[model samples]
Target: MLNAKSEIQKDTFEPASDNLSERSSILTEMFRKALFRNRVQLVGGILFAIGTPLIFRFGFDQLPINSSALSNTIVGSIFALTCGFFFFRRLIDYPGTEGIAYAIPIFAVTYGATVIVFLFLRLDYSRYLLGASYFLTVVWFTCISIGMVRLRTLRIGIVPGGSANALLSLPSVKWREIREVSEPTENLNAVVVDLDHSFPTEWERFITETAVSGTPVFDVKHLRETLTGRLEIEHLSENTLGSLNPDHMYLRGKQAIDRVLALLVIVLLAPFFAIIILAIQLDSPGPAIFRQKRMGYRGSIFTVYKFRTMRAEQVGSVDDRDRAITKAEDDRITRLGHFLRRTRIDELPQVLNILRGEMSWIGPRPEAVPLSMWYEKELPFYRYRHIVHPGISGWAQVMQGHVASTDEVLEKLHYDFYYIKNFSPWLDILIVLKTIRTILTGFGAK
Candidate 1:
């Protein structure tokens, strides 16, 4: 049997060794760098947006308009583009309208800001100029939106593997025309292959020739993880897990920053906290704060705190604790509890946990002890999440939402593993921003 352990190099899935191919082609290596494509597209889009003002200026200068109108036009465009950049930067990875979902909010905010600006400045421009500005802006964004959707819909080839089924089921990737491996073809964006799986001599030769000719090659496992944003547990082994060493220096720095920020948040939100406390007291008989034991860094257990969102229930044994999964329309949830849970204000109490060094501002969410124990027993490499301190909001929390069953929890752990494997401050910031959408939509709240 071909060894299923042959690993692909990080990021650049360049061939690990010469066994797969005789020699790598210069064009293939260049094409394998997909970041270059994204960068060029992004830079092109930004230049077009920045130049939009100039386009309007040229046209408006011919019309009977005051200089202030031109200045206001430039200012409004800058404001809109600035907001658009922030949203686009995050949404660019997603496919279809989902990639541009942030644009709707940015557009609304920009429209409001422009209305206020025009009102405040009292700048009266020709109706034609005003109408032209709005029209051009819409046209610019609409064309770019179409371009991005088409770019993401490129045909891709997949050499089937264990994760192929999962990738096939994801909606975001449904836009991609996925095909089985055949003779080398020039019309494909990228090819996903199982590096450890064997192929016929002719098939292997075709892949080598295609890869060397500037066709980007991707490992099936890595591509699936990138596309779905989840780490498949079945693909991981001891060597891979062992390679994820926690950077002590980085952790120390992150922890120090987390504590300071948590303290500041608590102080600022004290009034809101008091209001929530009062609401909880009036809504239920349980203590305002519910303390539960959760597994933390390096397998350490810590008491995590959250505002009580459910009725106080008696737990008589371990079996009862094991069955404590929250369900939709659960009778134990109070009216106020439902609101608090949906809004995630119930987690505000965890700021204290962060201050106490039991958690960070962002990391994997700490699973309750009973749930953690059950997961450890049922899931592979579940204990790996404890490598870092738990967090109030995490990759899993934002991406997968609240998991209620063993199957869902297994899916969540995939995201948790991805976060652990690729932890960075920028990623945490992105998650924090995305969490706002969740709070607003009350997505996945039980």
Candidate 2:
């Protein structure tokens, strides 16, 4: 067991001399404020990355202002740089340091879109200019992230009592316990307290004053959810924040977009799908497509599709509940099935489910009918996950993949609740980026 007070005292930094410390503090604050400001980072990125290149290319008379090359360069550079910048900013707010890992791929997607547009329109553009912009954009953000990591240490003040001590176990945060009402608060990034716990009058007054004095106050439960990307709900009413009720408008809009994109993906990947189907058939004597009943959108039953990676004969003899659980090194998985599952090629057919409005590109992954039924019986409010459409790639899938045991599923439920509670474009974008990593690295596939 950890002693919260001792741990916090050990982590706190002590100053040397009053005058020397004051001068150093002033300089550090000024540097931190300037460097960490979003506007400063944006302006610096645009000027150094986009503006410098523009000056050399067009300002030097090497390219005319009205020329197609000049226009394409401006449009493409600005598009890639701005998109990458904001995407990085949003992702950094989520828990984890892997936000920097996404910088390259985000730039790649934005720049690739520009190239695709230029090709389709038959417009003349300097490939070298766009490529350089992509490179510079990535380098700029990466450097800024590294600088922030080195310069910034989050100092969060924890109010002693209740479950506040539970947060001490979390890493990368400077935890300072507020023992006295008179404890200094100016240096603290935020104040964390267990809102559920009743505090004495002095501490209560301190919390009120802390909030009114401009320092942010956070409930320990919410802060932990933000830091860990998991939401553990002991009761249905614990979701009183109405995070249980996601943006209805976004949900509807997402479904429409999912349908259109699903159709487009199917159309574009038709030939590739044929190749996979042929490979599967050649490897095993079974139907190329595997269909299973799954619990989907709002507890509805739907048939989910996947490329058959398992032998046909072996699947029927097992019990439905037992068969639904894919154990590690399960022999039922054929040689090709292992590769397919690892790369998630087997899930490609779920585009059909998305087209049918039974699923989305991202949300909670649906479970097999038998498994879903069993879980709903064992777990509290399990059907609440079906409130949103089931997804192909989701928070739980990326965070803790391919779980089977009820204990593991309990933890997976927390991830799902986090997704449902914080359901929005940012979380969805994070899932998409993480899913790309999952595809390449096979982090969570069975």
Candidate 3:
């Protein structure tokens, strides 16, 4: 019995030793990772400084044909490198619009760098669109890159109680510490954090030492603003978005172009539209022309029109219960209706909505007034969308798919707000381009 006990004790002791060593190594690696993340902005600048722009312009123009072996290898390697970099770095957080928002600058920088180099290296660079594009691209890229780096490192992540929620989203000490508060009933900007994991001795020392000497710590909104290049509204709270004013929101003149383009579209597509109406009428017993009262432009209601895609009895008319949500493969859809809806030909009459003062070409998709009534009460800043005229196509429509429920509407509302805040001509161009692309892709069609 004594011999057996001695052997067991030895075994236990060996594992404990191994556990300590393993922990030490893990801790060392975490420290290195944290430091490396903190230094990304500095490193990005250095990498950018080496004139990546010039290299791209030369290489891109001369890039061999797609069928060439060298072309295939280089393209494969480049794409692989980008994917590896993003995936390994966890550069993308949430997918969909969130992912797109984060990635925009990365592309801008990649192309922009080539432009900058061309301008600096070539005397004739001023005559080309490349240099100008580079200049434009860099502004967006640098701002967003700094914002992301700041977000990752908590550099500009926090404002006076305004740091982004992403820091808490990260798998870090702060993430472990923040728990959902049930009792207080008040949203918090900052909270005392605790962790079962031991704090790094170096980090503990660094925070205690340097944090006291007037270096700023972040609030969530600060980081979001930095990352998004737009001031973010605060969390859902009693005073949440109290300062938010609908009048403060603006979309640029290019949106007017969206309106004009929409008009032109109606004219150009008029014959096809006539045929669609004929088809809808022939396919279903219901009227081809359907008009509904939709809320638009600061709570005013207007008659919106569409080609009826549902059977006369199966679908609700404008005056019917006003339950606007439609499901995928809904039984209501007629055979021809399905095809029309999928291709968005049913929405052609919205060009009339644009012509009429009720809508823009690209803004928020108008909802039924009764539904807006419920949403305005349920979702904070929901009415903010009404600040601008409703549009036939919108940022949310292009960036995300249809909203089937209240949850989806609220989510789409965030994208709408983001668009409202960053209403520039460039954004409008992108939205229009994307709208055309969507019409081609049919990704979100019924």
Expressed as tens digits, the lDDT of each residue in 323-371 for candidate 3 is 4667777887889987776677778888888776678877778987667
lDDT of 1 by residue, 1-446 (tens): 01111111112223224444544554444444443244544454445654554555565356434577665665565566556545555444421114334554545566557767777878653344444544454455556555444443334566544344445665633224334445445655666677767777765776787789876777777776666677666656776766466667778999999999999998999999999999999997878888788889889988888888878763223345544677787777888999999999989899999999999989998877888888999988889889989998888888878887888888988888877766766466567766878899998788
By lDDT, the better pick of 1 and 3 is 1
* Candidate number that wins on TM-score, 2 or 3: 2
Which model is ahead, 1 or 3, in terms of TM-score?
1
242-350, model 2: which lDDT tens digit per residue? 7688899999999999999999999999999999999999999989999888899889999999998889987652237998888899999999999999999999999
Per-residue lDDT of 300 in model 2? 96
Alpha-carbon local distance difference test for all models: 0.67, 0.82, 0.53
Task: Please name the candidate that would achieve the greatest TM-score relative to the true structure.
Answer: 2
Show pairs that collide, candidate 1. 28-214
lDDT of 3 at 106: 48
CA error at residue 155 for candidate 3, angstroms: 11
**Model 3: lDDT of residue 34:** 39
Ranking under lDDT, best-scoring first?
2, 1, 3
List the candidate 2 regions with Cα displacement exceeding 4 Å.
Answer: 1-29, 54-72, 112-127, 238-241, 316-319
C-alpha positional error of residue 401 in candidate 1 after TM-score superposition, expressed in Å: 1.8
